[model samples]
Target: MESHPPAGGHSVRTRSQHQRRKRIVQAAAALASRGGVEAMQMRTVAERAGVALGTLYRYFPSKMDLVVAVVGEEIDLLESSIERRPPGASTPASRAVDVLMRATRGLMREPELADALIRSLIMAEVQTPFGDRMTGLLLRVSAEGLTLEQASEEQRDLAGSLASVWVQELLEMLRGRRTYDQIQRRIETAAARLLAGI
Candidate 1:
């Protein structure tokens, strides 16, 4: 008996496959930004990406998969933006609030993307990958800018939970449920009052 090759004649992705996946993801995001998540259908996304419909499905098992990946990419971009900021503040509260304010303004600039992400989160359609990755990025970035003497395991967990709340509240503020001034004032006032009372 002789060994046989796979059906596609290649078992691993080539550079072309990597480029194809990138294009597909970009197309999906463009569609998502223009018409919301509904525009991210396999057929439409493939058409936009210049790939076959089967290829799109091959890359993304579900709609949630693609959207979650998009969310992850956006979060990475935001993380990089923070990484570029010069680290200065010494106090934990000061550093944390500075990072939060910077992130809030970034989200405000992308209302459509923020809306889509929030819908995915609230509907429970997206899964845990984004939350975990972005939370770690945020903690590392904030820790670098703050004077916290190494975040303990418990403190790290608390920071992750607080980050989730901050993101959700920021989305709500973007949706006009709360004004920007209100959110800004509330965040600073809470932090300041807590520090003062402590």
Candidate 2:
């Protein structure tokens, strides 16, 4: 039996497909920076990426998909940056806090992009693959930066939970509901409590 290639004529992505995907994501990010996610219409993205409108849709079915892809790419870049930095302070809590702060500061530098990505994340349902991926990347990056030496299972779980809370604090700060100092206080207090039992 012969199976025809999927709609795109290839089951796996070719180099050109990869390039087109990258270009589309970059276009989406550029549009987001210029005027946030609302500015990222399918037509505008296709025009900016130099791909057919249908091709863009083939890659990202909707604005939400594009936003999530863009956010995922941005987070990948941030993860590389996080990995390259030297280890932080001595304790697991402080090291984790430092990593969280760096991530927050990076987002603060690009308020519009941050808002667009975070907005998409908020709109995405919890069970969606995009939301889960975004959340998982955040947790992995934060936990990777922590200094968990011979940590018990409970402490390891606490570190991951703390990472999510740190990300939430960042979103709150981005929304202008909380000052950076306030976020800092909240995060520090929470991290302290999480580590107290260790």
Candidate 3:
């Protein structure tokens, strides 16, 4: 008898590689949540992820690279939530409000964790490529589930600006400088206004 090649040419090693990367990211997230981003060393993550130190470095390459990947995953989760919301059931403005509020609430739900990530991004501690990738992800997600052709260039710019404002305001709220209720009200109001002109 002869052994056959597996589907997609994916041997056991291939599957293990995928799993190792996933586990490393999951372990990093958990550790970051508990002790903040500084605690997510490669050796520490490898130990928690049940992989060898070399495996962790092979998967992540660098701390900034790993964090940028984490931010990308976070954006995907947020985008999924926004995409799943029922836009047809209400006015576009209302749908936009819902999206902004949902994102704000999610940030509030993980104040310290978010602060750590944002601080890394803003301080240029992360590699510029990954930081640019994260900003692109934000633009993609914010523009998703929207019909932008109807809007003018200025309108599009305004929408993007409002999104940045909303994220910044949420950061302030996370820092305890503003209340959640205040952020919610301001975001909803701004989203509604921007959507109207779009």
Query: How well is each residue in 76-138 modelled by candidate 3, as lDDT tens digits?
Result: 787677557534435555555566677667766766667766666565554444333333333
How high a TM-score does candidate 2 get?
A: 0.79
- Candidate 1 regions off by >4 Å? 1-12, 122-127, 141-150, 189-198
The window of 10 residues in a row where model 1 has the poorest summed lDDT is 3-12
Global local distance difference test of model 3: 0.62
Put down candidate 1 lDDT per residue, 79-177, tens digits, no spaces.
Answer: 787678743576544555676677777767767766776567556554445556545554565455322346566655655665666666777785689
Winner of 1 and 3 under TM-score = 1
Clashing pairs in 3: none
Flag regions of model 2 displaced more than 4 Å.
Answer: 1-12, 126-153
**Number of the top-ranking candidate, with TM-score as the measure:** 2
Clashing pairs in 1: none
Native-structure RMSD, model 3? 6.9
Q: Give the number of the best model, judged by lDDT.
A: 2
User: What's the lDDT of the predicted structure labeled candidate 1?
Assistant: 0.64
Ranking by TM-score: 2, 1, 3
CA lDDT of every candidate: 0.64, 0.69, 0.62
